[model samples]
Target: MVQKIGAQYLAKRFADQLMASPEPREEPEEVVRETTEVSGDLDGQIFHDEEGQPIGRAYLVRQVEVYVVSPTRAGAREELVRCLNEPDSRVYLREVDGRLSGVVYTPDPARTGERTGAMRADDV
Candidate 1:
């Protein structure tokens, strides 16, 4: 139901999904290779710890598999996910220049079960 987000992802179009590993897990060679091989969705993210060291699962965006390391979320990540489930609220992971960038919080468009204007036009 990705299209429920108002966009289609080919239903079966392959997208990479990574798992969140504990901060102590460190980066594995296989995990590193997997992230570098494909770029798409990531179930987890990689960020640097307070000590200026990398933590979490490293992932990539659209293509090229360019590595981009981000900083720690300072405990905000869990909160973001929780609030996304609230009424009319949406949380998005923003990517820029094919790297993990920041997060975007916005109000979701209310779904009325009616076709959008573009759909109506196509029906006419």
Candidate 2:
């Protein structure tokens, strides 16, 4: 689904940013976890709280985890996730491999019941 792909992309981007920061002198492996935190209703609606308003439509992008082996990893992860999801983050959606990618408000793609988990670039 578009939302699933979007969340994965966002999580990856956030993970990458943390790895590239100067706080981490050594490179750290990116750990991306994509899970359906919430599913849409029959009508394809997702509800979220926006300041006091109830936003009824929008694909929710969340960070399940973004961390490094260093002590500053948790703080770095928190800052990066907050920055990416903030109003000024300027994050947008993109399409890759025929599926919608990145974080943006949009409709989800239909599920085709296929999965390719953790395929490395060399495997392609």
Candidate 3:
């Protein structure tokens, strides 16, 4: 039987990818939010298809929101945007048994509706 998954699990998955990267040094300042939880019903399916065969499926049991900002770097948000754009710079998901679950990428802040005005907190 398939075991159930949760938001916290997906959050950790997102966090792990950020930490294990070379460019983005692992910092404790990262944050994760439980954006949404989607069940794998008939209408709910995430997969990649090549030709007529199915390459893999992403069991999106949960949708996790992540925020990573580093004070050491200038325009850290832009850096993240570039990193996430690279195909190699991706976050892959794994099941409890350590099997390849899916690949995830940090969404662009502008597209994801996370970015607001350019004014910094200290500028306020």
Candidate 4:
């Protein structure tokens, strides 16, 4: 029997694929700032690509939607909060309608405290 995968699992798989692929090209800092919209302060700062361009999704810390594969919503929320507080952890944010609507914790090489990249929430 094929086991159904939850949203969190799928998201993690997607993130793993992105991490395995070649790093994205970097653009000028000014251009990145103008194109990207971020609203939260991560514990370890935002990530950046090899050329110094930021990598990963953007979102407001106040409205991060956590998707934990838990049986209860409260459990999921607790997991989300825990993930957010992790030191140097990279939480990928998903934006919606110009605001942050979702977030997923994933492993990324660009989580080195440098903010770069112009990422649209819908893209995720």
What is the TM-score of each predicted model, taking all chains together? 0.20, 0.25, 0.23, 0.23
lDDT of 2 by residue, 1-124 (tens): 9999999999999999888757736655886766554443423465557665766766544432223211254565554555555554333456668665444421112221243358788998
Q: Local distance difference test, per candidate?
A: 0.49, 0.51, 0.54, 0.61
Candidate 4 minimal-lDDT segment of 10 residues: 31-40
Q: Could you tell which candidate, 1 or 4, scores higher by lDDT?
A: 4
Query: Candidate 1, residues 2-79: lDDT per residue as tens digits?
Result: 566444453324332234444575656664333343334443567678997878786553432222121235645554
Give the lDDT of residue 105 in candidate 4.
64
User: Arrange candidates by lDDT, highest first: which order?
Assistant: 4, 3, 2, 1
Residue range 1-124, candidate 3, lDDT tens digits = 1234677777789999888756756877868765433454523354556666655555543434334343335766775676577554545454555655444444444444544348778987
Tens-place lDDT per residue, model 4, 20-103, is: 968888866764323234433554567778998989755445446556433356666665565567675566667889887886
**TM-score for predicted model 2 compared with the true structure:** 0.25
lDDT comparing candidate 2 with the true structure: 0.51
Model 1 whole-model lDDT (C-alpha atoms)? 0.49
Error of 2 at 71 (Å): 12
2 versus 4: better lDDT goes to = 4
Which ranges in model 3 have alpha carbons more than 4 Å from their true place?
A: 1-46, 49-53, 61-64, 70-81, 87-124
Give the worst 10-residue stretch by lDDT in candidate 1.
Answer: 63-72
